[model samples]
Target: MGSGIPVWSDLTISDGLKYISGSYKIAMVYSGDSAPMLVLENKHSYSWDICISASEVSSGVAFYSYDDIAQAFSNYGVS
Candidate 1:
């Protein structure tokens, strides 16, 4: 909760990596978009939160995997 990035907030980590909360770091495959809690790059920084621009953003991790993220978005009518 003292990570400065707060918690349960949707953020864009980078381009291919995303952050999740559950007393641990979970990744590999998700179920939907879910708007990553602490979006970031695992190769760059896991504990620290980094900021980036929309056009500058590269490949990071999404809270979901493939259909998972897609599903979550669809469910929320995110299109």
Candidate 2:
């Protein structure tokens, strides 16, 4: 993995409804297993990809926590 999670990667999140405010992202990934799935990966963390439940999220989409997304990225590029 790299120093930390890259800002380019996508984190999938679903609510079984429309896209949440900040609870998800839009991305593309390959499918596997006996079913279909999304691909959420951070360039920094190439060692492994985070497989999230997509019962609500649309495939190839990245999702973030609507509650903490803004706070989480408060200092993303403040430097």
Winning candidate number (lDDT): 2
Query: Could you give the C-alpha RMSD of every candidate to the true structure, in order shown?
Result: 14.3, 11.9
lDDT per residue, candidate 2, 1-79, as tens digits? Answer: 1123344564444542355355454333434432234333445556554443334334543333434333333434210
Worst 10 residues of 2 by lDDT: 70-79
How many residue pairs clash in each candidate at the backbone level?
Answer: 15, 14
TM-score, per-candidate, Cα-based:
0.25, 0.27
Predicted candidate 1 versus true structure: per-residue lDDT over 25-53, tens digit per residue? 33322234333342333454454433222
> Candidate 1: lDDT over CA atoms?
0.36
Model 1 — TM-score against the truth? Answer: 0.25
TM-score of 2: 0.27
